[model samples]
Each structure stands twice: as C-alpha cells, then as structure tokens.
Target: MAGAGSWFVEQPPAEPPAEASASFERLYRAFLSARAALGLALVMAQLISVVLGTTPARSTLALSLSYAVAALALWLAPQLRRGASARSLARISSPHWWSAIGVDLILFGVLHALDPSGVNYGALFVMPVLMAAVLSPRMLALATAAMATLGLLGAAAWSLLAGLDVGLKTTQAGLVGSGLFAVSLLAGELSARLAREEKAARGSLALARQQELLNRLVIDEMQEGVLVVDRRGRIRAMNPAARSLLGAASGELSWQLRGRADWQPLVLALERAYGGSAGEGGAEVDVALALDSGAARSLRLRLRFTRQREGSEELCVLFVEDNRELLARTRQEKLAAMGRVSAGIAHEIRNPLAAIAQANALLAEDVAGGRAEQLTRMVASNVQRLKRLVDDVSELAPGMQPDTQPLDVSALVQETCEDWVQVNGVEPGAQSRFRLHIGAPGLTGLFDAEHLRRILVNLLDNAHRHAEPGAGAIQATLDRHGDALDLVVRSAGAPVPHEIERHLFEPFFSTRSRGSGLGLYICRELCERHGARIDYRRATDAAANEFCVRLRTPSSASSA
Candidate 1:
C-alpha cells in the first residue's frame, strides 16, 4: 500500500500550474456526484424488486444500503467543498483509497458475487473503470480495470468449483474483461486531449486581459484626448483628457454623441467616418462648439475605425485636441527657439554699442550747442535704448541663475522708486506724478536685490507710460500680510484690454511698436526664480490698472 501511494501520488511541478489544479478539482467533484446518483438508483431498484415479489437476500439488501450511505458521505464531505481543501481528498495517490472509484469497485464486486436470483451485476463495474480512466493516471486506470476483471473471473471460478455450469460463465467474464481494458485506454487518451485544449484556451484569456489593462493605463495618462464610441453614438469609453476637452464634469460618466447641441459636430464627423469607404485609414476634422458660458471652443479631431469584421461590432476612436491649446504650444516652442538665437545676437552687440557711445561722446565735444550736437544727442538717446534692450535680453538667457538673499522690502522699494523717478525726470514733491508709500518698515523677503530693482523699474516705467501727469498718477505701495510682502504699483489709467492682458508676460508680445516687450517677461521670469508671483488686476477703489508682486518672507521660506 505504501509503494502504491508513492507511485500514484501526483508529482506536481516546482510551481504547480493553476489551470491543472483547477481542472483536477472540477473532475473530482463531477465523479463524486455521479457515484452518489448511482447509489440512489441502486436503492430504488432494490425497493422496486421487493414490491414485485422478487425480494433479494438479506445480505444483498444490507450491502446496497451501506454503499448508498458511504457514497452520500463522500460526496458531501466538508473538506471537498473548497478547491484548496480538496487537494488531499481528490489526489489519486491517496494511501487509503478513500475515493469513489475504490468504493464503487469493492461494493459492486460483492453484489456481483452474491448472485441473488442469478441476476448479473457485472455491468456495474463500468462506472469505476470510466471514473479511474478520466480522473487518475493511465497506469492507475489500467490497474483499476485489472482489479475489477480479476474479481469477475474469481466469481466465475467460485461457481465452477461448486460444480455449476462453468463454460458460459467463464467465457462471459473473459469477454467483459477484454472490453473493460479497451474502455480504460480509450477514455484516458480522450480525457488527456480535452485537458490540453482547456489549458490553451485559459492561457489565451489571461494574456488578453493583461493587454486590455495596459492599453487602459496608457490612454488614461496621455495628454491628448481619446474616445471609444460605437456606431449608434453611445460612448463606450473616455479618457481623462477627453473629458477635460469637452468641459464635462468629473463625476459625469454616461454620454451620447448627439445628446447635446454642442456635440452635434462630433456626431456628424462620426457618421461621415462610418458611411465613407471601409478601407479609409482616417481623417482630420475641425469642430467648433458654443459653450453654455457664452464662449466658443475650437477643436481638432482625428477619427479612425476598427476593422469591420463579420460578427463583431465596429467602433470609432477619436483623438481630440483643443485647437487653441495646440496653437499656443506651437507658438511657445517657436518663441523658445527665437529667444536662444536672440540671446546669442545680443551678446555680440555689447561691444559695438560701447564703441558707438564713445564715438558719440567725442563728437558731442567737437560740436557743442549746434545742429551737429543735436544729431549726436539723438544718436546717444537711441543707443541707450538699444543698450537697455540688450541688457533685458541678456537677463533672460537660458542658463542665468538668480543671486537670492534676504533684504528689507520697504528699503528696497523706496530706493528703487527714487532711482526710477530720477532717471525718468519726474518731480520730487507732493505734486509729482509718481508717488511712493511705505506702509511697512521692517518687512524682509527672499529675493535677488538687482532683480527686484529691475522688476520695480519695469513696473514704474509701465505705469508712467499709462498714467495721467498729476499728483499720485502712479503709486507704488509696500505692505506686509502675515508672512508675505506685497509691492503693488497702480496707475490712474484705463484698464488693460482683455485680449492684450492675457499675453502680457509672453515674449515679444506688446501693444507698443517701440516696446522691446522683454521688460514684463523678464520681470516674470526673475520673480518665478525667486519663488514670487506677479499678477495684474483692476483696482476697483481707484479704477486703475494695478500690478501686484507677492514675495515670500524669510520666515515663510524657511518653514517651506
């Protein structure tokens, strides 16, 4: 028995395959059910025979009842209810032969030997033979068949020893044994083939699920929008980017292509794609939508379709991109390239500019207080403007880093405003056009000193250009709020136009032809480097354009 247990034990691979274990559990349960059903059928047949005045021997009745009870017990065993727990009970190598195959063979053999009313029970042996062939190894199945054949022949030999007619009995047992052997071999081969096909199908299904998850992850993280739609205009799937482009709320899931008036253009595009040639690769289309907020949105869409197969539904995939955003991205790339080239050119202009200034100074000395002097003065002024432009451009060079340090916000604002007023030749008294107010004295902030000065000077310059010439026409105020320092420059002028305000900090964008357009842009870059923010708004109290610079104080910076 020990040797038989070792031989029949299933030697699973180092990492047992999940599919193989699952298949074994399924077959095991199926055979248990069949055994229970056969047992009940035998009991019913015995009761019916007794009713017909054909009562069997008392031992035969008891044996049939015992077989039914044992079969029911094994079928409903708690350990066999779950796959993990069923492994030991279901293994063919079990030492005790506790399975239905062993029980069926023993009980059916005894019943055949009883020979009640000479009714043959030999046909019952087929159940155990087929069960072993499908559930156990090929050699084990053959062994089971041999055991049953031996029991049949023994019963026949027993009858022969009793001096009964032995010729017909021995011949019949021999023929049944031959048939059992063939059944065992054929059933075992067929079961093996089915198992192989099932394993392959399960492997394919697992691979397909993994691929689907990967595609979903990639689509969700993409910057461009993606949509999956069927021919009936129902949205099957949509990525985050697509939802954002459509201005759909985050919680909204169900959507139809033709559900809203704004989505009609998309509906038409989808229809065109489906109605056109099946071989068409894809096409790009422009769509304009009127939003509920009285605004219009422009989008570019690329549509493609899955191959229309015979039994599968065709789907359309739309790649959506906001046209305005696309244009802005392209423009930013062009400007970055231009800024690099301009920085190089600005570096080469410094030497020539210095020479021109020296030459102009010399010419002024030779021809003072005349038309020639005026021409020289004009040349000097233009040269200074070009030099300022060059300086601004150099500050914006790609690799430039700020020299950040702590400084008194009030003192810096006061000094920068005084210098700007002197350079621009503004008056110094109460009636002066440019006014400075210091609301906080000891406020310190982290910033580059020279960069801060440049920012202040640019804001003052912009203010002077737009403000009326009167007292408090341009106001520079410094104040502190909690751990922040704010410098607000306000000018009493008409508010900046909405269209131009959006591009104020963009490179090379300006309303004035003579403006270098680098002043505000350079200021914005410097502030960003120092962890500061600059924004423009209309001062409702004064009805003036206000530009506010918010700086991080030392304590706030340290905490961060």
Candidate 2:
C-alpha cells in the first residue's frame, strides 16, 4: 500500500484525441516567413535600379509592378505548404515561379529592343534565384539551365535580325553565362540532398531512442515477472523485475540452491498442472510451492508457445503473477471457523443467561444488598455484548437475489449527490468544488436500484467520516467499462493501511470506534447479490485514496 502522503489534484478530460490545429499553424508561419524574405529583397533591388541612372522610366515602372505582384504572391505561400491534396505543391510552386520568370523575360526583351548596348542585363540572375527560392533545388536547377540557353539564343537572333549594332560574339557570352548557372545549380542540388539526408538520419535516431526508453520502462515497471525461454527451457530473456523475483544476479542462470530457490518447485508445479497439454495454444495454471523460508506460496502462471520455424521446436514464454494475497484469504477462512463456533455456543448459552438475569432482578428488589445489584448489571451487559457479536456473525450469510431493471445511472448519481448536499445543510448559494464526471449516453444498464443506492449511501457515509478536515470535498464519477458500469467516489484523506485493505470486506471488522464493522461487509454482500463485486485498494495515483465500486449487470436467464 502507498503511504499517507498528499498528492496534487488534476482533473483530466474524458475525450478522444482530435486533429491538431497548432501544428498546422506552425507550418503556415514557416512558409510565410520564407516567402516574405524573398519578396522584400526583390522589391528593394527594383527600387535601387530605378534610383540609379541606368534604367528607362517605362522599364522601371514595369519592374515596380512586377515586384508588387510578387509581394501579393507571398500571401498564398501558406496554402502551398498544405500537403493534404496530391497536386498542392506543384500548383503552388510551378505557377508563381514561371510567372515571375516570364515577367522578367519580357522586361529584358523590351529593354534590349529599345537600347541594346546600354542595358546592364546581367542582374537577370535574380529571376533564377527567385525560382530556386520558391521550388525545390532540382526543379529550380533544370528551369534555370533551360531559361539561360533560351535567353542566349534570343539575344543573338535579335542582334542580327533587328539590325542592332551589338558588336560581340553572342555565343561565347551565352556559353560563359550558361556555365556559371550550371555550377550554381549543382551546388544547390548537393546542399539540398545533404540537408534532407541529415534530417532523415536525425529522425531515425530519435525514434530508436524512444523505442529503447519504452522497453526499459516496461521492464522496470511491470508487476508480472516475465521470462522468455527457448524450447529447451534455457533462459533467453529476463527483465529486471523477473530477476528480482527469481533472486538472480546479472550473469548467473545455473546455480545450486541455497536458502532461496526460485526455479525448481514453482516451475515444476506449473508444468504438472498443465498435464502435458502445453503444446500449442496458451494455457493458464495455478501451483502451490513451499519456499525455503517455510512459507507456502501459490502462483498463477500463463504459458504461450511460438514456433521459430516449420520443423524446429517452439519457444515457450511464461508469465508468473504472484497470488499470495488470495491464498492467505483462503487460509483465513479456516481460522474464522473458530469464531463461528464460539458465536454459536454463545447463542446457545444466551437463553439461560437471560433467565438468570430476570430472576436476579426480582431477587435484588426483595433483598437490598448492593453487591447483588452490581453483579446483576455486569451479567446483563455481558449478555447483550454476546448477543451483538452473534448478530454480527450471522450477517455474513448470502442474501436475496437482485431485482434488476435498466436505469439512467448518471441521473441517479446526480440525484444522490444533490440529496446529500441538502442533508448536510450546505447552502444552495455556496460554491461546491466537487467534480462530477458522467460518461456519455448509452451508459445505462440493468441493475438493482435499491441495492445500488444502499451501496453508494454506505460508501458516501464512510468517506464523509474519514475525510480530512481542511479539504472537505468529495468527487464522484461514473464510467462505462465494456458492458458494465463503474462508480468511483474519492475524498481527501489518508490511504487505508494494507492490513486493513486485506480484510475490508470481511464481516465484524472495522477501524472506527463505534462502528458495527459491517458497513463495507454489507456493501460487498449487496454488490455480490446483484452480480457485481466490491473491493477496497489504495489509490496510489491520486490526491487522496479512492474507493471504486464496479457494478456488472446481471445476464438474464431466458424465459422458457
């Protein structure tokens, strides 16, 4: 059992996972930032060219208008980052990239036709750089090489056909420009591939680390001792939990028994229970073992076999769960027979003791001795105590069957809480900090309403008595567990001790001063009558200890 330490409180939502809007917003912002930087640089370059005395007014205006259009294109970049549609990337990058290049090409043609020798058109590298910025490196490299060749051919043809006196070897200049563009394209492709590969490698490394961490967590935190053995029963894998249970160290699989032996009796007992039926399908078996410490223990073990090859033998995986607690309870039933016999003998003696007390009361009235009066009082008190003990023992017997019908469990819980609030005299205006979590619709099921109410009322009363002083709050929640319903009531208080938890449902046992010791015992009896079970265990993961009631609906027998 967990110790009596207060933990922090948090109310988690009862809902499924939904699509994440924050991740989409982050991707959108990244796209906009990249596009904005490119558009701003282009606009600044156009302004600088116009401020200098090298470009004509009409050309300056055309560049300014093109920059304005490119600025507008930046707003649409976020849509391009969306990968849900198959053709989204192509539609976003290809249209805008080609449009910017087409505008630049038209402007270059117009300037050469107007004044062929004066325009310093080498700055046209900006168009290809913009293409590289918008699309991936591979597409940008191919587009740049094609655009450079076309520009060279168009310039040389125009110089001859339009009669412009541009005296130069146009093919040589074209070759030089195309060579520079090719070098830039190669550099971009290599850098992009390197970045992509590095990113993929990092992702894979992180994933591997995550899986390793998960494996260690499972090995350390699991309660069931897990062992993986080959067909020959040689130990292949054993987690830390298994090692601790088996009393083995890092490297010793075969060792002679000393004061502690974990292998022989436990394993042999399970095998014997299987009765040689451990070939293929999974089988569960229970075994009793006498440990070296003179304590007999029972374990519930499950074995599963998986064949490594078609012809090869199978490997058996064993899961051993400790069932010492249940075994102890089974033994306690024998010890309780003494109490049952004592109570029965007390009942047989009670009638004669009652007659003696009545006769003594009459004799005391006649004779007036104070000693007789004191003796009479003592005899009456002892008789009453014995009668009470016998009554407590009798309540342990099984009772009436459940009268079940379908009921709205949430509404019933709400009504119960409201009635409690009223009974406690809490004002309607006062703030109630208690949280109520009711599961969704169709949580209704057939159950005995009166019996369930009695169980809840008893649990609530028990919580109210044991709750901590300052944090006078209780939370009630309803949950659907497969086809059954679960009711949980939590209050701020110390956890019930382990010794108390073991006999919590046993009749005539309690921790209170004036309690009948039958509150929880009766609750369990009622729950069992309705085809359900009530149990008490410490809530190690909450701000306070919680007592949960699991109510399984009864399966109806068909009417013949």
Candidate 3:
C-alpha cells in the first residue's frame, strides 16, 4: 500500500516563468507587426521602380511575391503566440530573433540583386536591420548587421558576375556595410538606454500604486465620511463611512446612484466649488441627501476640485463632515478634562455616602416607628442610586478590556435574558415572554463573556423597562453565521422619536432625567473593543424598536 502522506500531497499553485513577462510578450507582438508593415512597404517600393521603368516587370513580380509571402508570415506570428503555453513562449530565445532578422535580410538581398541595373533600393534594407537592433538583444543586433553585410556583398558580387556592376559595385557594397555596422551600433545603444528608462518608469509606477493603496487605506478607515465624485456628480468612489452616513445599505440603488436626479444636490455643490477656473469651493456647504428611509441627513460637505492635469480625468473630493460629530469632538475634550477632575472627587464622595447608608441602617434598628422606617428606606434607595452613578463613572475609565475567548453566543444570550427577567420582575410564570430564535444553536465564536453579558444585560434591561412585561414579549435572536455572528434585541414599544434617535448613542445625552445616559455609549465602546458593532433601527414592526449587534473582524465592520 502507498504511504498516507504519498496518497495525499499538496501541489503548489502554477505560475508563468519570468521570461514570459507581459512586457516581453508585448514587445514580441509589436516586432512581428512592424515587420508585416515593412513587407507591404517593400512591395510598394518594387511596384514604384517598375512603374518608373527603372526595373523590369519580371523582377518586380518576383520581388513583390517574396515580400507578400513574408508579410503574410510576419502577420501570423502574433496569432501563433496566442495558443502557446507560458513556458514554451518564454523558451523562444535570441536565436529565434536572429533567424527572423536573417529572413528579412534575405528578402532585401534578393530585391537588391534583382534590380542591380535599376535605382539602388539598398536604403530599404536599413528598415529590417534597424528593427532588429531596436527590439532584439545587443548581440543579436550585431549578428543581424553582420548577416546584412554578407547579403550586401553577395548581392553586389552577383551583380558583377551577371554583367551589372561597372566598377562602383564593390565601393557601394563597402559603404553600405560600413553604414550597417554603424547603424547597428548606434541603434543598439539607443535601444539599451530606452529599455533602462522603461524599467525605471515601471518601478516609479509601482511606487505610485503603493502610495495610492495607502491613501485608500487611510480614507476607508476614517470615522468621517469621504466621497470622491466627478464633475457630473457621479460617485466615483466612496468609503464605508459615506455609505452608512447616507444610510446606503449594500446593493441599494440610493447607495450607488449615478447621474440620477436624486444626487443633484451633491452635483450642484461640486459646480459651486469648481465654478471658476481656480477650482476652489469658497466655503463648505450643508447638503441634504434624500434617504429612501424618509430620513433626510444634512451633511456638511467640503469640496475641492482635483488638480486638472491634461490627459487625466478631473474629479471632486468631497470631505463629508458630520455636523454632530464636529459638535461632539469639541465637547469630548471638555468631558475628558471634567472626567479627570470628577474621578478624584468620586472617591471622597463614596466614603461619605457609605457612612450615611450605614448610619441610616443603624437608626432603622433603633427606631421602630413607621416614619423612621420610611425615612431609612428612602435614604438607602438614594444611596444605591448614587453608588450606581459612581460605578458608571468607574466603568468609563479608559483602557479597560474584558477577557475574551471562544464562547457559545446562544447560551450567553439565554443566561443574560434570564438574569434580566429575574431582576426586572417578569411575572413568575412569564419566562416564555422572552423569545429565543437561534438559527445556529451550536455555533461558537470569539467573544469576551463579561463584555457580551454587559451588552446583553443593558439591552434587555432597556427592553424590559419599555416593553417586556404586561402584553409585550421581548425577542432575542441569534442568526445565520460563519465568522460573523448576528444578535438582535427587539421589543414592541412607542416609535422612538426622531429627535432623540439622532443622539441615542451620544454619551451623556439621555431623555430620562434619572438615567445616566451612558448605557448605549458604553455598550458601543465595549462592542468596538471586542470587534463588534451595535446599531439601533426602527423595527420593521411599526410599534417596535430593535438594536442589532454584528460581531465580526473589526477592520471590516464599522459602527454607525
């Protein structure tokens, strides 16, 4: 029996050989094409000599036929190359090139010898020898010149033997031989120089491509939206941030609109920026994109026209700046400063608050009256609220990360839901009020259990507060998988007001006075740390709201 390893072996992928580089293949094709054209010109030259009565009709016919046949063969070389394998194509060495130049030299020699009595068509021979010098290797070019010298001498000697030279045949052959050698030397050097410049240009282009890739990476990873459009307002390119800012979901027509009337507002902005030849927008403009969701987003887009270089497409680069983010960025710095000051004070406040809670407990034990007991309960409740406020601030301290590993998502969701149901006072037998729709129950993926727990608990806590008990049942769903895990928490509730919805995840922005307003913001930060995304959408059910968490590789997933 064959060994197990021998039975199952991995084969590396196949690739073309280096010599079969696209550059060489293209050069070969061009060389063949030029030769074909040279053949036609040769036929034309022969016909013209006959018309002038400088050459006989019989010689003209023979030369014309030879040139016609060679031209047909030259034209067919590219066609043959199309069917060859990479290795075989690269195997075509310098000798093949030399052979081709030899054939061309032979044709020129025949034409020269046939019309020795007529006008010297010797200048026509320069075309093929020069062609070989420009395209073939330096050694091959020298060889081509040597072969051409032999053909010239052979043709002149034939003319002398055929009663055609007078005394100038040898002199003419020597002068032409000198010209061939000089032409080869000069053309070969120039060709070598041109080849070096071309290689340098290719290297420069590779560097330019790398720079472009880096620019694309920076743009794609920006939190601010970026839209690159043409003068026609066609979205030439856009990052995922722009897509989400415009609420353009994947494969959506509105997301990828081209030259449509709906995108006119953006196009008009481009014209305003590039209106004059100066190509500068006087200032940023606030343009609203008409989203299909019926929510119009007013975006502050700063436009600058591309440097209009000739032979290049001109475009407009629109820097999409969100007004809310601009406002938030300025406030975030102030918040960070305040957080530092408050963190120092929170410790001092905690000790006094703990003392007051202890004193209230001791007083409750001493006083048996209804008023005293009620006062103690009130004191304890307020103290707990303050402590919770303190804890929320502590959680916000920077650089915190939860331990992560592969975990069962369905089990995590189920456990958090059960804990939330117990704490929030769901009716004793109303466990079924919370629904679990697990498409992949056995699925396991990377996640921090504590982080997932906090996220789920916060989501469920909000759901219970708004719609879980009474007639409304909260729904928790874990859906179709792979590396990506989708979990959604939804419940029937009054439609979230658009005004509040805009700032829903903004830190310290809360509708409820007693609430800390950090639940969703902290949830988002936690989700981001664990390579997950949290987004709230008005539920498809008109009376419901849904928050969806997508857990995937962080780089590919961006939070709205």
Q: All candidates' lDDT scores? A: 0.81, 0.58, 0.70
lDDT of 3 by residue, 277-342 (tens): 536443578987776677777788877777778898887777887777887787998877766666
Query: Taking the tens digit of each residue's C-alpha lDDT, what string does model 2 give over 207-301?
Result: 89999999878866887777766544467677766665555687755333232454676556435534575665767877665654566657776
After superposing candidate 1, which stretches have Cα over 4 Å from the reference? Answer: 1-25, 44-58, 76-86, 90-99, 116-204, 247-256, 278-280, 291-295, 365-367, 398-415, 426-446, 497-500, 553-560
Give the top-scoring candidate (TM-score): 1
Residue-wise C-alpha lDDT for candidate 1, range 1-560, written one tens digit per residue: 21121111232221235656666667767877887888888889889999999987887788789988887887898564444322343355563344567777888888877664666777888988987777666667788889989888887887877777768778878888888998888887777666555556666787899999999999999999998889889888899999888876676665677887878888988888788854437788999978656678899999888888899988888999999989989998887788888889999999999999999999899997879989999999999999999999888788677788999888888888878888889988878888888886877989988899999999999898989767899999889877898899999988888999999998878888999888889889999999999999998987699999999988998888
- Candidate 1 accuracy as TM-score: 0.80
Query: Cα lDDT of model 1 overall?
Result: 0.81
After TM-score superposition, what is the CA distance of residue 248 in candidate 1 from its true location, in Å? 5.2
What TM-score does structure 3 among the candidates reach?
0.56
Name the best candidate (by lDDT).
1
Question: How displaced is residue 305 in candidate 2, in Å?
Answer: 39
- Sort every candidate by TM-score, greatest first: 1, 3, 2
